[model samples]
Target: MSNMEDEYDFSHPERGVAVIINNEAFSTPGQEESDDRAGSSHDAEALDTMFSGLGFEVHRYDNLTSSAMVETLTAIADMEIHSKSDCFACAILSHGGDDVIPDNTPGAVLLERQDYVLGVDSGVVLVASMISIFSDTRCPGLEGKPRLFFFQACRGTNMDPGVGVKVRKTKVNPDVGPPREGDGAEQTDHKDAEEGNVDIEDSNVETNYDSDIDNTDSIPLRPVLSVSPSNINKDILVMYATPPGFYAWRRDTGAWFTQSLRTILTPYNATYWSLTTLLTHVNKRVAVWYESSYPGDTSMNEKKQVPCITHMLTKDVYFRPKNMKHSTLV
Candidate 1:
């Protein structure tokens, strides 16, 4: 267990706000209702229950357009309640892909790619642009407080064929540990051969539009105060549904990442585990316990996914017990 002083103080009267953005329908100019995401509501409801049980004020938004997404997030960042809260969290579930740009080098034919999430209207919003709204210079109320962002969307259309692992049978002994080397053991591939249907967050037909249509440019600018830019990005954590250029899977139940997250961060578990520890457990659950079973598509069958987590948190974070009374810890 970590010392109390090492953990971010979660004892403030307000635990914090948790914003959930669930985009299930798409109605872009050329898109059909068939492009809508299914089962995203399950994720939203699970997140709401989990965060609300953790004492957070949960606010859920559904089917927002690109401009509405930016507006909603910007308003949350400007909320005065943040000044009295201990942390902040936001989760976005929608279709996502890479933002491609023409390489400008002379005679270059390659394209540059950046990560972005799509709004219901199929508008593009860079992931970086969303994080910038909560920078220390912009959202002063959240300075020095942990800010968590969770994205459940595909980064691209690539499928992951998991690597093979060697399995060995050996005698068990109390003092003996697992072998470090394979020792020429036969390798076995683990794949889910069951017949089932799964959905990828990527669109079947790529939508084309002017790159200048990105809605991030229209984000309302806040007054820039004289804060050190050095730590503008401090105390932030971002978790993506999948690695770059990989697909995120969903089913009738919910998204794999979100279901695993909800399972691992139960109210009881939150009391004993640090937030990072919980997330690691979530990573393992999603990576090992789940796999695509779309037998109809051979290429997508048995595919695997691993979530990506990046953080700049300076200290450990712990969620307070539900029944605990509030008191300033620092």
Candidate 2:
């Protein structure tokens, strides 16, 4: 593996991006529904803090039309299919189903299958494909930059209660550990500081203290565990609002996770934290705020909503701009 620090670049054309899609309205059968702009304004300010000077030009747009969704993505992807450019990051806020959004446009822009996966993912392959267009043509000054996506919408129509809190990391007792050296470890995902990511392995990274023997397959399948080769997009990271089979909370007037996300990014100037560290703080802030908002709501106290971060960064990311010195990672 290449050393993460060695991947740094002094000149980045675009610092990075935080595309916030506040879908506050939807078109339905000749009818239109407006979402809360108050929440949108709140979330936009939050995302802007994270995007500003992160390594790309910060662009902001209101809820897009159904037709505009695909078209907009196509147009932007064309800008940097490949080259040593700044990274890509986006935040989507909308009423969601399985994998589609009801943009305020005429026809609801349905998403592709690959985009349905967890963590700031959605029609991302299409965006990645667009990046390939530039790379294939050997586009000058725009290749190898990471593409990060942050999605804050429900994956499916269904909504079930989610596990909102964790007293601590769950673990198995050593007394119950299985005894055997060849048993190997189970497949798992783990985080590393240098790479600023949580990587998946063919074998689980977590330990089952109850089992004395590791249960993982000794044979390495780098190809299987790594992000599919079919996806050439490199250094990508996605941070999602919640997990499957759960409700990503939103108030009639405010977006729960989004509001907190902005709180962390905008104030105190925290741009130096890595992707993992950012999410870790995000998870904490979101959970704490949710708990406080509904003081009387019992279920709220029990459940903790965390941002599901899917990271694939090359080098460490700071909580604040590397060039600028900030006392606190806001």
Task: Judging by TM-score against the true structure, name the best candidate.
Answer: 1
lDDT of 2: 0.44
Worst 10 residues of 1 by lDDT: 211-220
For residue 299, model 2's alpha carbon misses the true position, in angstroms, by 9.7
lDDT of 1 by residue, 77-112 (tens): 889899999999999998886645566899987666
For candidate 2, write residues 73-163 as lDDT tens digits.
Answer: 5566556422445556677665443322233556845422222321112222232443343342444434455556776665433233343
Clash pairs of candidate 1?
none
Evaluated at residue 248, the lDDT of candidate 1 is 86
TM-score of every prediction relative to native: 0.75, 0.56
Please give the distance, in angstroms, between residue 85's alpha carbon in candidate 2 and its true position after superposition.
3.6
Best candidate, lDDT-wise? 1
Stretches of model 2 off by over 4 angstroms after superposition: 1-10, 27-38, 53-56, 80-84, 99-142, 157-233, 266-271, 291-304, 319-330
